[model samples]
Target: MRLIRWLVPVLIWLAGCLVVGRAADGAEVMLPEKFQRLLPLHEPLGKPGPFDWLAHHPEPGQTFGQYVASRPVVPDRRRRTIYVQPLGEFTEAQQRIVELAGRYLRIYFDLPAEVRPAMPLKLIPASARRRHPEWGMEQVLTGYVLEKILWPRLPRDAGAYLAFTPTDLWPGEGWNFVFGQASLRQRVGVWSIYRFGDPDRDDETFRLCLKRTIKTAAHETAHMFSMLHCIQFRCAMNGSNHLAESDRRPLWLCPHCLAKLCWATKADPEKRFRDLAAFCTEQGFDEEAEFFRKSLAAIQGRR
Candidate 1:
């Protein structure tokens, strides 16, 4: 009993000394400073919590001229082209990026034959990444600037943001949070390799995560069209969770946003949208294929 008393007092005194020192230094006493403390509180704070993307806009400004100057363009005006050009030695998940992005471009924004799609998704040699290690996770999405990638083929009247995510995302575990981006960029990219197969499945613990990517990629591209994320009505651009969240999202834009996109791209709503669906099915998205079909029908019915 005596030993316990002495030991307890000393321990208490030491703790008090540390606390006083910390207070003197103006250090916070956040409980989760240690993993053990945070273990019981597994849930992250805030809505759209974790795995969130671009909390803000880029400093240089997200514009066409600046975006075009970032990279060189290569012409491939064939009716439909999806290039998976390797930027550097990339992981299989990264290399598959083209087909992944192409999967959505084919559905959401498949430009006509005149508007070629030059997706910069490839597996370059290790030397390439070594040469430019500073490239971010979402780097090279627009490796080919807007004009360079779409000019001579399609009109230059839009912007594109590639929400590159590490291949290990799930519904919500708060992966890859470096902070400082605007809320507009939150949850930007959906669950790829973050989903199912694609080899990223082994590392990713959930199977449902696979399908989520399809919806996400398409969602981000929709933003490139000058359309704000959906606010009214259940829409494809409503922002999402699992594929269901995305599925709940309608394929077409809200009437307001749709009007804006139409004004920006000036695509003949019915023909261009229907044709885009045809292109997606050609690439293998029966689900989105059907979605786009209905989207075209919905707009056409209005006309």
Candidate 2:
């Protein structure tokens, strides 16, 4: 079954090549045509299941064209860096995850991604802190972190100012907790590692936690660039109602969302895939590395 899951994308890539032929020199065709050839390599999203995110949110998804038409935020010369602000306390292992996440963001967006000096969580006032009535877990207000803490400190050269905390977060009074939250226009966001599991537990758990943290970090930062939740494919940009749904999402973007990232950040598709593959390989994300390798091969007309 796992083999089949892996082979399906390869088969799709082959079929896409037949449908959209390569040039005489085996180079990919021109701009949009080259991009179009890659689209069918990704599977279209099917109907949402009972507990799926779309079953609840029902978003009208954005396409690459729509994304461009929307005049989505893109990094410019004056605002080109992505900043990661560490909030509260992190274990040594947890801090490693944060550092890796920053590295991933750099390659993911083809931008400078740096972690600022750690900021004290005491900055979040007592009024913004609470204990979950049912679970008794300590929680911090997501809004306060974004608006009060991060927004004010957003650097002039920052394309996105992101905060990562070891603390749990609740969006407001109604919600139980959020894995993360971002302001679409403000270019600032916050995510919690509290729910991603303990990195010190075991190797498997460590990788799992690292993967989840990077996913949320990259996903939320993409939002700051004005990319909407993906509904077209099994992509990293897909909305998630819970951990199971989130875990089901791919670590790589589908072609459509990839185009958005490329367009917004002026990233070279081939180089982006290569860099991501290298990072995943170094970090022991074998499956994700394989997928990125395939993406690089597909784009380079090697398969």
Candidate 2 structure quality by residue, lDDT tens digits, 118-195: 998898899999999999999999999988998899999999999999999999878999888888688998989998
Lowest summed lDDT across 10 adjacent residues in model 2 is found at 22-31
Q: Which runs in model 1 stand beyond 4 Å of their true positions?
A: 1-97, 103-107, 110-158, 161-211, 224-226, 241-244, 247-251, 301-303
Please identify model 2 stretches exceeding 4 Å from their true place: 1-31
The alpha-carbon deviation from the true structure for residue 53 of candidate 1, after best TM-score superposition, in angstroms, is 13
What TM-score fits each model?
Answer: 0.41, 0.88
lDDT of 1 by residue, 1-303 (tens): 999988999999889856744553223222222212212212222234243221231122122222222231222232223222222233565445445555545444444311223333343222222222333333222212222322323333223323333432222123332211112222112223423344444534222233344455555554544344543344455544443345445444444434433444444556656766775566455765676666565554431
- Best candidate, TM-score-wise? 2
Q: Name the Cα RMSD for model 1.
A: 21.3
Supply the TM-score for candidate 2.
Answer: 0.88
Alpha-carbon error at 79 in model 2, in Å? 0.7
